[model samples]
Target: MMAATNNKEPQRIHPHKFTLWVAMGSIIMMFAGLTSAYIVKRSQSNWLEFSLPFVFWYSTATIIISSITVQLSLKAFIAREMKQYRTLIGITAFLGVLFISLQLVGFYNLESRGIPLFGVKSNSATSFLGIITGLHIVHVLAGVIAILVLFIKAYFSKIKNYSSVPLEIISTYWHFVDILWIYLFIFFNWPR
Candidate 1:
C-alpha cells in the first residue's frame, strides 16, 4: 500500500468561527429532520393545508434588512467608524425584535383563522409550523442577544480591542438565520 504523499498547506480559520460553523451544521441537520417529518406526516390523513399569513412577507423583509444592517455594522467597525457601527448594531437589534414580533403576529393570525397551533383542534401541519418557527425565533433571539453584547461592548469598554472577530461572528450568524428563515418561508409556501 502506498502512503499518501500529497502535502498541502491547511487554511487557518478562527476557532470561534469554526465552532459556529459546526453549530450551524447541527442546526441545519435538526431542521432537516423536522421538515422531513413534516413532509411525511403531510401525506397522512387530516393534514390541514392553509395559506401562510400575510405578515410572513413583512417578517421576511425585516429579517433580510437586518442582515444587511449587520453587514454594514461589520464594515463600519472595520473602518473604525465607531458611531456608525454603533448605530447599525442598534438598528439590527431593533429589527431582530421586530422580526420576532412579526412572527408572533403571524401565529396569531393563523390561530384567528381556525388554524390552532396547539390544542385538540390543532392539525399536524400547524403543529409542525409552530414548532419549526418557534425554534427559529429562539435562534433569532440569541442573535439579538449577541448584538446587544457587541453594542454594549462598543459603548462601554474603556480599552479598545479593535478586533473584528466578534462582529464578524455575529454577522455570519445573523446572515445564517436570515437565510434559514428564507428557506423555511419558501418551504412552507411552496405549492404541493
Candidate 2:
C-alpha cells in the first residue's frame, strides 16, 4: 500500500504577537468580569444613573482616527513609503495623545457635574464607570507608547528597509483599543 505524504509546513505566530494576543485575552476576561460585576451591583443599591461625559465622544472620535492612521501607516510601510509611513505614524501618535487628553477632560467634566470619578465619594455606578474607563485609558496609553517607540525607531535608525512586524503589532493593538472603546461607549449607553 502506498501512502501520500503531507508537504505543508505549519506556520507559527511570532512570540511577541502570541504574547500580545494572550495579554489581550486576559484583558478581555478582566473587563468582562468588571462589567458583570457592574451589572450585579446595579441591582443592589445606590446606583446613580447619569449621562456619560460628552468629551468621551470627542475621545472616541480621536481614537477612531488614530486607528485609521495606524492602519495607513502599516500599508505605507508595506509599500515601502518611508515618508508616508512616518507621517501617518506621527499622526497616529498625535491622535493617541489627543484621545488621552480628551479622556482626562471628560473625567474633569464629570467631576464638575458632581459625579465622583473615583475614591470613597463614588457610588456603585459611577465607581464602576470610573474603574472601567480608567483601565481602558491605561490600555490606550500602552498602545500610544508602542506607537511612539516605533515612530522613534523609524526616524532615528539608519535602516530604511525596516521590518513591518512592529507596525503590524502596533496597528493591531491600536485597533483593539479603539474597538474596545466603541464597545464600552455602546455598553454605557445601552438602555436598562
Could you estimate the TM-score for every candidate?
0.94, 0.94
Instruction: Encode model 2's per-residue lDDT on 1-192: one tens digit a residue.
Output: 889999899999999899889998999999999999988988875789899888888888899888889999999999989899999999999999999899889889888998887788878798898899999999988988989998898889877656788888888889999998999998998998
Q: Each model's C-alpha lDDT?
A: 0.97, 0.89
Counting only residues 3 or more apart in sequence or on different chains, how many pairs clash (N, Cα, C under 3 Å) in candidate 2? 0
Q: Tell me the spans in candidate 1 whose CA falls farther than 4 Å from its real position.
A: 1-11
Error of 1 at 100 (Å): 0.3
Candidate 1 residue 190 C-alpha distance from true site, Å: 0.2
TM-score of 2: 0.94
Please give, for residues 54-75, the per-residue lDDT of candidate 1 as tens digits: 9999999999999999999999
lDDT of 2 at 113: 91
